[model samples]
Target: EREWPLAYVPLLIDEKEWAEISAGLVQRADLFEAILADIYGPNRLIEKGILPAGLIAASPEYLRPIAGIRPASGHFLHMVAFELGRGPDGRWW
Candidate 1:
């Protein structure tokens, strides 16, 4: 398997459990939004739960430093995997 992971959320959550679970989203969003705002003047949805931290971090392509700062725009996994070969330092970028 390339990767395996598990996540659990209360899509069918009860009213009493709703607030508690969602609370973490609020707190997490606050922290995330603050960081983004400081960087990009508030990224709207990225500040909301709609966009996730891992997604932004996992974005295979992006140039926040080279583009966001320097400009000219930017953006995926620029990685390569060998069929059955491997090397210690030739790891994926």
Candidate 2:
């Protein structure tokens, strides 16, 4: 097996940039939580045609057995991580 490569230099971010990134991450997490909840709960997105039923049905991540079951914590997602990279144009994408 090949060993994974590591970055020798640490990437640093300014406080202002970090603040913006953090805010965007939080917003995205909230949206993900809502989408998961909807998929496992009412599934109105499918009914309303906002999301295709076959898409969820075919998704490996979709657990049909757990549909409509509320978690004890009352939230579907507790934590999330995102991989962000800067494009050649110097914009984060």
Candidate 3:
């Protein structure tokens, strides 16, 4: 099933709706960048008591095996996924 895929009907949105969706996506990406930066950088949240140090260490997503190995490009948390949703008005945007 992974080798082949089915095509879906093309989605068409007005410029206004497209702009709203694009802005939301960009904002979310920026937020992810900030969170990742804090986690792998200075860790101000843990220092300032906003986030518990124990929680981060206990999380399964925290990769202890590769703790010391930094990416040459200095990038982490490279994947982000969002659910497609609609409001009560039934608009995807």
Top-lDDT candidate index? 2
lDDT tens readout by residue for model 1, 8-89: 4523556765576466556656665455444343445566767775676667653366423422332121222322212467
Instruction: Please report, in order, the local distance difference test score of every candidate based on alpha carbons.
Output: 0.47, 0.88, 0.75
Q: Return model 3's CA RMSD, one decimal.
A: 5.1
Candidate 3, residue 39: the lDDT equals: 70
Go through the candidates in order and give the clash count of each. Answer: 4, 0, 0
Positional deviation of residue 1's Cα in model 3 after best superposition, in angstroms? 19
Candidate 1, superposed: residue stretches over 4 Å from native: 1-11, 41-93
Model 3 lDDT tens row, 11-93:
67789988998889879888887766677677887899988999989998887666545677776757787755566798763
Itemize residue pairs with steric clashes in candidate 3: none
Clashing pairs in 1: 60-76, 61-75, 61-76, 62-75
User: Which candidate order results from sorting by lDDT in descending order?
Assistant: 2, 3, 1
Residue 2 lDDT in model 3? Answer: 48
Kindly list the per-residue Cα lDDT of model 2 for residues 8-85, writing each as its tens digit. 687798899879888999999999999999999998898899999999999998999999899999999988989766
Worst 10 residues of 1 by lDDT: 70-79
Greater lDDT among 2 and 3 belongs to 2
